[model samples]
Target: MCGIGGIWNRDQKTVDRSLLQSFTQVIAHRGPDDSGYYFDDDCGLGLGHRRLSIIDLSSAGHQPMASGDQKYWLVYNGEIYNYLELTAELVALGYQFRSHSDTEMILAAYQAWGYDCLNRFNGMFAFLLWDSSKQLLWAARDRFGVKPLYIWEQSPNFIAFASEIKQFTKLPNWKAQVNPQRCYDFLAYGMLDHTSETMFKDVWQLRGGQYLTLNSDRQDADFGKLTVKQWYSLPSNQQDLSMPEAKQQLQNLLKDSVKLRLRADVTVGSCLSGGLDSTSIVCLSDQLRQESANNIPFQTFSSCFDDLRYDERQYIKDVIAQTQVHPNFIFPNANELFEELDHLTWQQDEPFGSTSIFAQWCVFRQAGQSGVKVMLDGQGADELLAGYTKFYAALFANLFRKWHWGKLVNELITCRRYQNATEIQRMIEPLLPIWVRQPLRRLLGYASETAVPSWLNGSYLQTLGVTPQVSAKFALTTPTSIHQLSHLQITSTSVPMLLHWEDRNSMAHSVESRVPFLDYRLVEFAYSLDDTTKIRQGQTKAVLREAMRNIIPESIRTRQDKMGFVTPESQWIKHGLSDRFEIELQKAIASLGQWVQPDVLQKIFQATLDGNSGMQGVIWRVISFSRWLKVFDVKI
Candidate 1:
């Protein structure tokens, strides 16, 4: 629950304390409670931290905390929900602690178990440990990507790391240079091709489940010498799954996950949207808390909008009634969001063009004001449980291509899937070759087929430097699921944008948000489960609903809609921003040399203003890239 920043100068030069201080200060919103720094002038290493006290509110919680023997110092962000448990295990192993702080637990754990400490804990986290004895640095991101970490390295004397990329702007030479291919990927797929790359050319996000180590003596920063190891990833099963067994396993894991996430010293609540994921989270979390005799009546939070077409407060009300959990509703206005946009984008360290992000932000703000320090959310459930309609759509595509029309239609009916919206038709009508519906489809596939043979194709290594497994996953649609479920990995343009919004919006209020369903184990298991478990007999999220049968409101449990924290964005753009959209769009076109095609953007703006928020995806990508270029000063 903090922002961390630091520098390691291989040359043993003193790091400018003011610079590190300045970098971290920019993210003070992330950790307003306290700030700390650690430096070893002789070792050319330094670490700085901004704290948002949660677990241990004592002075013992002060960070840049050191191991008992003082061999290592840690500047950590995020909570180790199992710290008390890990602490007991360490004490049994003869470890001594001076504080109840998880930071101390983290430092001690690293000292005792080395990098293996990651496997023994459960929580959202991103941390860096400076091993004074070895002059090496170790950092790890959480298993579920709930917390974010960024890294930058060049053949140089310095390698910088931080919880947010804006801290890197403190670098003397850092620039906002845009990566063209990133724009292409963002436009085509909504994210830069892989996890490691960002919109910026030099900075990279530490892919979740990966850790990195840098040695002071490595002249080139020796990326080869820098280990990027994954402690967690979805497991693979060569065979399909049994629905009954799958349901039981999902139920057990989910309950355990909710219980673990609820471990907090502060008030804990759940984010309940109209969607199955969040609703289920509220039900199970409230049930688990109540059964544990914790007597902690949890609070439920939901976002509100003037547009009831997209608002689902009724659904939230339904669940609250069932659980007796008091509900909090926050209404966000586009006008207020207009003012917060720049600061919000700065916190995210990139331009986020999604308006719905504002809705999530309002919820987080309300949580902060309600005096809640930690909130449980169903962030990863969609990815893990085949909860999105896009998954159904992709499954439909794969089945029809394999000529399994009966199976496709049956699953479609069971999932309550729909088809051919006017907007979708416009994009695909001409692009989808008429012959593709039949035997001629094979030829049509060749057009969108990537031109370069990826590492997955078993060729010479690629210039992109993406790993073979990563390249293969990119080549396949997405989700890295089994053959029958592979197509479900496809992320609509709005999905990635929404996730970015989620992270930035939540962190903006100094509130720690946790997502259990995204855990690699759960994700892999969900995908490996038989598709029937996810969508059965005209019900989406069937297995999840059954697991929470008596916990969630029966009305909501029976609801078929899967809309997430949706915002009535189109109407807002039309009534609140019509002039700004056109003026800015035209200006964007005028600077085509420094920007992307204005015409492409104008149409997206018009469509959205004309009351089609779904089209906001393409426009969101373009606008994000445009703003990123202007902010970063990328010439291309």
Candidate 2:
């Protein structure tokens, strides 16, 4: 994977070649191997690329690559795992290639099939193609949003796009203005969005599953003038199939997805958290390699902790005992987190929700140091397959809504025995009226608290303004059924947030992270299955358990407790980080007084100091936001 940046002058002014070079240099870490540039004076468009050189090491693979006869130019980030198949198909249709690179295959496919080539691609990507022949700019991102693409418009006529928002800072007129509404949403509701709006004013993230087309000939264009379209969407049509048939279909899809992601010229490894999602990736990868007579030990990276409650070493050991692959472990501590706090915040480019993201950052850093270029991960499984405890509520809600009382009771008992859960409140939740239950859920933090936090300055809150509903888009609207919930997780909520963190963390270390579970075919197959298939017998990801029954050790396969990438944040706040955290908290209050209430902030800090562990997360977010402000020198 690599970083892409470019500028298009809609007013047909001469493009600044130096500006492209400056912005592209800012994200050099994303692609350090080589850099390329292409500028067309006639169209006033410039394209720049930073290459990581994964597939083919030869110069033939270099990009801003032009097609023969110079009709098209392309800059791309990400791998096309199915390039070989597409290449073969294209050649049979009279297409020719110069290099054994996925980039070339993409160009050939586009040439042969035009925009229709997007539907045929089976990998993560954010690409921009300059069709000089058509005098149009075509841009697209991968279906699952595994890759990032940001767009900024200087005016209706001039546009700039990049792989990261930081690249935009190099523009001569670039201003770092804070988006107050986004800040309010983030602080009040913890609403991290996957929508078009970004934290920075005038800069926007292109939603995943969407593409852009802009005409070179259009004069004095505007944001609305760009023809943006959603080409991909999660499949909602349920197929008529038995559980057995669905399981077989899902098994085949996953196997093929894993095999395709294994396509790389450089060394590949995987992140193993000892949870079902990651363990399945590691074990399945090893099994597939063995089947292909490639017996090289697959490298697995994990973060372990001294706190047994937060550690998954036992489950990790179980997977190791069964597969016996090469393993690498990291003991991430509060010290490392504190030391890298500012750097991590800068890398993320935004305030992240939790410290669990640091554990993932450490995993990617270790992978880079170990000389692994591409790391396969299990990021999208939980969202696609209802693999969280929260999904249990959705399941019970469905049963109660359907008047399946006997089934609900039987499942509750089975869950109590299997998961050792005593939360009877969940089983009784569906019986309450929507009005009464909704407020109760919000009070318990089961729903996002849209009410302004007690810590916000009243003046600032009033200045930020209020609406009857400012959070409808960011709110995780409760789904009607377990299937619909899983679908929303992929389309709107958890998976998108998780993917954003994974991409930023991995790319910070210059490593490409591939997620097999996010393969559209696999996602479609999983979502098509009945909710009972996913959470069978009170086990989340139950179908996955059945598919990997003999492959993964029974101990890990049947694990009911899942603590994926958890950390000792509360402990750190109370002990190891008390002094520094207090200092940072005070600094944050002073720096953000206009937006934050100093008295309320002090009270929150005092609560954390008084051994209220839950209050530590609030302190962390304040510290993160403050650091981000200083790092970016942001303006309100």
Candidate 3:
């Protein structure tokens, strides 16, 4: 809901007012309504904030706010959906407030419970709190990292934190330098934001469920030490529950999450992709609106395409017929996407996987143009509920490993009847030993996990000691259960990258995007359910369908095809944008230098253009990385 930045100069140099302002101003698109600043000359610390004014739009909501005793100064960049509830509790404890804002609630809570206050919060947030009396600085991100916090340490004594990495460019002595390992990871494995280390060298992010603290009053040896620690983590234990019990609990949790996210001063809407995750939110939100008698004319936004192969207009219409909602749609064309490629790349602050991100960018843009400030989206459901088809492989592996032939056979039949089941090869691939599978993949001309891509410069990667493989943090060699795979995806692989896209795309237009499904209570409960409850009769998110049986239209509740904000990347490469693709490909090969092989990449692009290959993802990476390098003037 806002942009926040700060400077902690441990050497005790007076913080420059203009430099702090520059850091906050660079990301003004995130918060354009108001700005605030605070300086502590004695501690050599300063905080800057750009306010979007979601919860309380009055001047009282202005940030860089101070506690009643003026002991703590806070600059925050997200919403605490439960702030109203927290305020009531704090008031009961005799705490007074000057502003009707969540910012004040946080200060009062911290004054009462200290760091333990984070355990009581249930929302998406990233904030910096300066304890002026103690000469201490505290920073923390939300449980699921729905908000972003980047840290740049020039040295142990001087550190800067911001909501976006672009703010670091405002530092006087800073230069943009590419991190080769991250570049290789994106080009070869399509990974971004998978770890704390970002694509820029020396720039790190505070991971989700984590916090950091710095004290200036310590001994010389520990003076500049920044202690980072985990504040929350997913529950490792699963709960045993009947199917009926699990469905009711999930429905209740989701409904409450949606209700909490709807607590905003500005206009709020939902992102409808016609898929189960998004449709469920829209339908539930409408249901809530009618029950509460809040007639603000609930609206929904979606991205559509003329190409039916890549469109979900039919399903979108189905939902509209069921709910009393006003629907808006945007048709994102390849020409428009290319026209704004540089801007979108700069907004993202790094290269992304595919044009699907452009589709999302268009959705947020449309929402902003329509005067919607906060939009609820469905992002975490897929990871938590095993919505991806690839999860089917993990389900089969779990059953086969346990030697449950009866269940395995029944699942295969159900899957074939209800789902595509075209990934049967992948479903059975996990059963093969690694030694045998590696050789078989090689025989099929497929690259193994350790094998470097032909288009990448193997020698350059070797010199940098960069192995072109998936991050071990996300790699599950052999997942024994859907829960294990869900844990990995939620923690490292999918949710982080998706959240990155969600934040940037929405904030680029000053829109606040919320993910109700990522509420800690809902995420924990979803993960605790049995795999059968998630994927039953071969349908993904089966429990969600049953929970919304009458709440949503039957057509949508039983829908199977999974396409959330999908774009026609392959079709564009072959038809509408072939010339542009070739031009960008050549520019990338020339500008990328030793990091890529020109001939190999050219052949790959040509193969895709000729409809002989399905390497659209690789092609887009090349185009995106090239533009990112130019947009930020990154030094290779």
Candidate 4:
């Protein structure tokens, strides 16, 4: 809902007001209504904020908001949905508020509870707080990583942070360089889910569910010295709940979560795709609409690809028939929007190769033109619940590796995920850990960053010298490092793609979008479910589908494929983008020096042209990285 940026100087110089101004100006689309700044010379802290004003549309909500005694000043991005409840609790504990803004409530809550306040917050957020009384600076992102926070910490005096990576460019002496290791991760898997390491050398993304406490003094601000801690983590399975119980609980949680997010002074709408998640959200939202009897009803926007096989128009029609919500279509033709590519690339702080991002961008653009300020989306359901087919495949493989072919084949045939039980059993043989597979289910996850490909045997993402532990850290659902999860095929590329796309395109037209499915509590609740229920009985999200049995259509709710948001990159590479592919590859090779093997690169490009899907992964990585460099002036 906002863009937060600031700098901390150790040796207190006359603060460069323009630097702060530039930081705020670049991300104006994030918070277009107003801007605020807070500076403390003694503490060497300067905070800049651009407010989108979703919660409270009043001047009282204007931020760089300070506490009652002006002892703490804060700039935050995201909504604290439980602000009212927290406010009542805070007031009970002698904390007072003058503004009816969530921002003000955050300042008061932090003052009363300090860092403990984060545990009580239930919404998405990334914020920086300067404790005037204590001279301490704190920055924390949400538990689910709904919002983004980027930081630059080369030296203490140069410690800076921003809501978007582009805001970092506003700093006085910023330079752009690719962290080679990050590029390697991108090539390995379309995301870099590690800590602070971005495509830009010094600029780093703050991992979700993590916080930073740093000193302003350059000499004292050693990363080695600061101890960053995570307030929350996703435990594999701490609860011993049954699948039926989980399905019912998930349904209730999702409904209530949607109910809370339905709160808006302006009109509410939703992003609907042919998939079960989006359709389920739309169905539930429509039911809420019917109960409210507001007569306003809800609106639905869906994206359409040129390929009929991938298009979900029939599914959208099914939902529309039942709910009768006014549905709009945002069609994306790769050939047509190639011109918009440069601008769309710029919206993302780092480079993103997925053309599906542009498709999401088109959805928000339509949302803005339709006069809707907020929209709900089903973004994180896959990661939280076991929606991807790959999980089961991995599980089956893991079992087979332990000579449990009987159990593995039974699962494969029941899940109906693969053909020929013996073939699948053979395929899964090498996947087991040296240890037992029945208990641990050691398998090659479809999202495994450490799993090297045939062509990727010596790929840079592996040899570029980052630890597989680091790679694994990024791939985790919980927060340790931000990069891994951010780029998790589910979270990194898909979730962030929708978020950044919605944020920019909606803001471009002065509309604000909200996603309830992405609520941290919902995310936590989903991740907490048993993996067995997620991909059970030859069904992905087995519990999730059952939960919505009465709501979403049987066809959509029972969908077997886990195609969330994707484009035909292979088709584009060969026919549509042939010329652009040639030019971009040449540029990437020439401009990026020797980061990738040119022989391998040409082979990859030719493979795409020849209909081989093997190189699609690395080609997209190189192309996305190359395009990012060309646009952002970033270099290796």
Candidate 5:
């Protein structure tokens, strides 16, 4: 994977070559190996690229690559795992290749199928393709947005696209202004990356499964004239398959996905958290390696903690023993996190939810240091399957709505026995009336759909016309089945933010991270199965567990507890880093200005430190936002 950027002056003004180069240089870390530029002065368009040299190490892989006829120029990021297969098909269709790179495959496929080529691609990508003949610019992101593409429209005449938001800061007339609505959603509801609108005003992202086409031919065109369309969507169709049939299909799909992602010139490893999702990947990868007789001990990276409450060393050991793979570990502490907080916030390009992101950053850093260029992670599995504990409530609600009283009671008993699910109130809350559920949720310290947080400046929010309501996009209603809930999480709520963090963290270290579970085929297949296949017998990712039954160790395969990667944020805020956290909190309050009530925020922090409130997430958001403002010099 690499970094890509482009500028198209719709008014036909000459494109700034140096400024385009600066845009490319800003994200140099994303692709440190090489850089290239393509300029079309006649059309007032420039495309810049930074190469990480993953698939093809030769200069032949160099990009801002062109078609055989040189009619189309493309600046692309991300690897097409199935490039070989597509290449064979394209060659059969008389398409010739100059390089053994996925980048060339994209051009050939597009030439053969036009926009329909997006449906055939099976990888993470965010790319800009300029059709010189049509004077048309086409941009698209992957089906799950594993890659990032941000758009900045300075005016109708000036439009730019980049792999990261920070690239826009280098523009000559650019000023950093905060998008208040996104900021409010972040501070109040912990919502981010859920919509195309970003934290920066007038900047938007090309979301997953979507593409944009901008025609310079339009005489009076503006951002409104840009045609953005959804090319992919989650499959809502369900299949009636038996447990055995579903298990076998899932196992095959996951294995094939892993095999495809393994097609890389550089060394590839995995991020193993010792949870079911990650361990299953490690074991499957190890199995694949053995099958191919590639006995070089597969490398794995992990984040460990000394604190037992936050540690997964035991589970990590279990996987290592089973797989016999070379393992690398990093111990991330509060002090280290604080020291790198500013740099981390800058790398993320926006405020993150918790310190768990730091743990992940540490993992990628260790991998980069270990010379692993590509790391396969288990991110999309949880969202695609009903892996979160909160999903249990949705499962229960679905059963109740269907009048499956016997099944619901059995599930409740089994869940309590195996998973130790004690949130009886939440599990049954979905069955209650809206009026009853809202107050109960508030009492549990969860934000109601319409209740504004007391810490937020209500008057300031009103002035900005920003409503402080939690997004119901992922909410569980009476009709919301587990599949529907999973779909929501995958599309709008959880997976988007997770993928955002994954992309930024991995790319920050110049490492390509792949998620096999996010393969569209695997996602569709998983969604097609019944909900029981996902979370049966109190087991989350039940189908995956059963699929890897004999392949992975039974201990890890049947694990009910889930902790992908965690940091001791609450503990640190209360004890070791309390002073530093307090200092940052004060600075954040000062930086935030009227956006937050200083007194209220301070009380919340104090209560959290005293172990009287569970507002560490809020405190972290405030601190993260403050650092972001300073790093980007954003105007509120």
Candidate 6:
């Protein structure tokens, strides 16, 4: 894993080495092991990298690594778990390698297969390859958006790309300016994955499963000349399979995915939350480890909280007992959440939606301190499998809308008995208008329907030319099958934001977090299966339970609650943070009047302090944005 950045001057002026070095140094936390730079003065092209040695510990793995012919150079970030396999295939094709590094495999693969090499990859990655021979640049992000890459077209003739947006700030003439539209979207609807646009105005992300190519020969700096393509997309057609067949296929695919992710040379551990997803990974990984000659205990990391509602210590202990794994726990409270707000926000590069992110931050920090370099996490499982209660409601609503009343009634009864029919109201939720739904959702502690918070300034939104409603790109859709909802959640909605948090939090501690659930094959297979296979007879992740039967602990396997890295934000606001929170909130209101109504914020603050948990979302969003504005010196 590494942090990579580069500059390609279309104007053909040599890039200043010091400027490149400075920009690369900005993300040193992403890669603390080694650093290198490559520049071609004549072509005005430069690439810099900071490496966190995982696959190869020797200098042989150093990047910006070059091809044997020196015609292509790669500054890469992320691991290709299947590199050893790809290496064998390349060697069969007469390709030679100087090192066991995946970086070398990438260079040789590109030499033999060109851009087609991307198809053969089965890992998380983002890379900028300088094709000196072709006078072009090729950039690609992994299929599932596991790794992040940000791009800024500084000028028509100059382009810069980095693993983190902070590096872009180091470039001369670059000012950290807030993108008002994204800010409006974030504050109003809590939407962050609606588009490629970032909170920073000019900087944009290279969307996952996508690639960009630039021709140095085209002297015109027109952004229009950039050719961006979606190299991979989810399978749209669902597959017809019986429960047994589906379970077998899923077991094989998921096991292979877990096996491949455990390919790193350094000690690799798992993040266990005692939840179904994390516990499943830990159990399966431990099972795999035991089968192999390596008999050492695998390390698992988790966050234990004082608040019982937010803690999963019992489940964590259950999994550890079953798997016989070493368990490490960190207790993060309101003090740590408030104390590390600024630095954590800085690491995230954008404002997170809630305090739960701090819980994850603490987990990763503990992993790094524990001398574990690579950690396996269960991030994308909820999206892939129909694990969220919201999905259950969505499936019911879709059935009712389609006049499948018999099925709907049967499922509703089952849900009430097994999973609680709490989400049944979501069946009629879409019929209500936004104005009514917004208040109703808030009253019920469900998600808010309106895009913007009630406390934001209406006039400011008008000036920004956006609305409180979610952007059309992100407007929620009611799908007929669990598979369809899974695709939408994974690609267009929730998983992207979660992936962003995982990348930033893990990288902040210089640790690599791999998600086995995101393995494309597993995601695709889950999407192809029927909704019944995923959420059957009121149980979420039913197919997963069936597949892991007798393997995962019964406590986690039978769990109905879904607390994903959860924190007690509402309680924290109501009790622990009244005094200091009011002080900071008042400062934010004073500094942020142009974007929010001070009177409304004050009311919300008072209501929250008065023990209204519904307003916690608003309080957290406002404070997070407020702190983000200050930490990044963001100009609105």
| Most accurate candidate by TM-score | 3
Candidate 3 residue pairs in clash (backbone atoms < 3 Å): none
Give lDDT per model, in order: 0.68, 0.82, 0.89, 0.71, 0.88, 0.84
Better of 3 and 4 by TM-score: 3
- Writing each residue's lDDT as its tens digit, candidate 5 over 1-636 gives 999999988666578778899989999999999999999887688999999989989999998999989999899999898999999999999989989999999999999999999988999999999997887889999998999999999997788899999999999789999998888878876778989999889999988999999886544345326789999988679999999999999999999999999889999999998888888888889999988999666899999888988888888898888776999988986788988988888889999989999999999999999999999999889888888877788888888889999989988888886654346556777778888988887788776667567898888778987865545433434335788788778888889999889989999999999999999999999989898998887777888888998888777887776677898889999999899999999999999998889998889999998899978999999999999999999998
Which candidate number would show the highest lDDT if scored against the true structure? 3
lDDT of 1 by residue, 1-636 (tens): 888987877665688898889978878878889999998887677899998888778778897988766788899888887788999998999988888788888887887888888888787788988887777788898865667788887446777888877788778877666654554455444554255677778888777678988765434445225667878654556336576666778888887787878877788887878677888788888787778877766887888876889889888778767775878988887778647765666666665546666678789989888878788887766555566554554445555666777886676554434433542332222323445532332333211334322101213223444233333235333231223343223132322344556666777888888777755456666767765567666455778877766766787777776566677666666777667656655654554443344455566677677665346555555555555556555565
Error (Å) of candidate 5 at residue 53 is 0.8
Instruction: Report, for all candidates in order, the number of backbone clashes.
Output: 3, 1, 0, 14, 0, 4
TM-score against truth, every candidate: 0.86, 0.95, 0.98, 0.87, 0.97, 0.96
Name model 1 segments beyond 4 Å from true: 217-225, 238-242, 292-297, 393-409, 412-499, 591-594, 607-614, 630-636
Give RMSD to native, each candidate: 5.6, 2.3, 1.4, 4.9, 1.7, 2.2
- Residue range with the least summed lDDT across 10 consecutive positions in model 1: 452-461
* TM-score result, candidate 4: 0.87
Query: Which stretches of candidate 5 lie above 4 Å from their native place?
Result: 218-224, 419-422, 470-479
Q: Candidate 6: misplaced stretches above 4 Å?
A: 218-224, 418-422, 431-452, 470-477
For candidate 2, what is the lDDT?
0.82
Give a tens-digit lDDT track for model 2, residues 473-546. 44544565788888777876677778888988998999999999999889988888788888776788888888
Candidate 5: residue 599 Cα off by (Å):
2.1
Candidate 1's displacement at residue 577, Å, is 2.7
TM-score of 3: 0.98
Sorted on TM-score, best first, the list reads 3, 5, 6, 2, 4, 1
Output the lDDT of residue 304, model 4. 82
Model 6 lDDT per residue over 441-501, tens place: 7777543544455577766678777654555346554565666678778987788899899
Clashes of 6: 4
Better of 1 and 4 by lDDT: 4
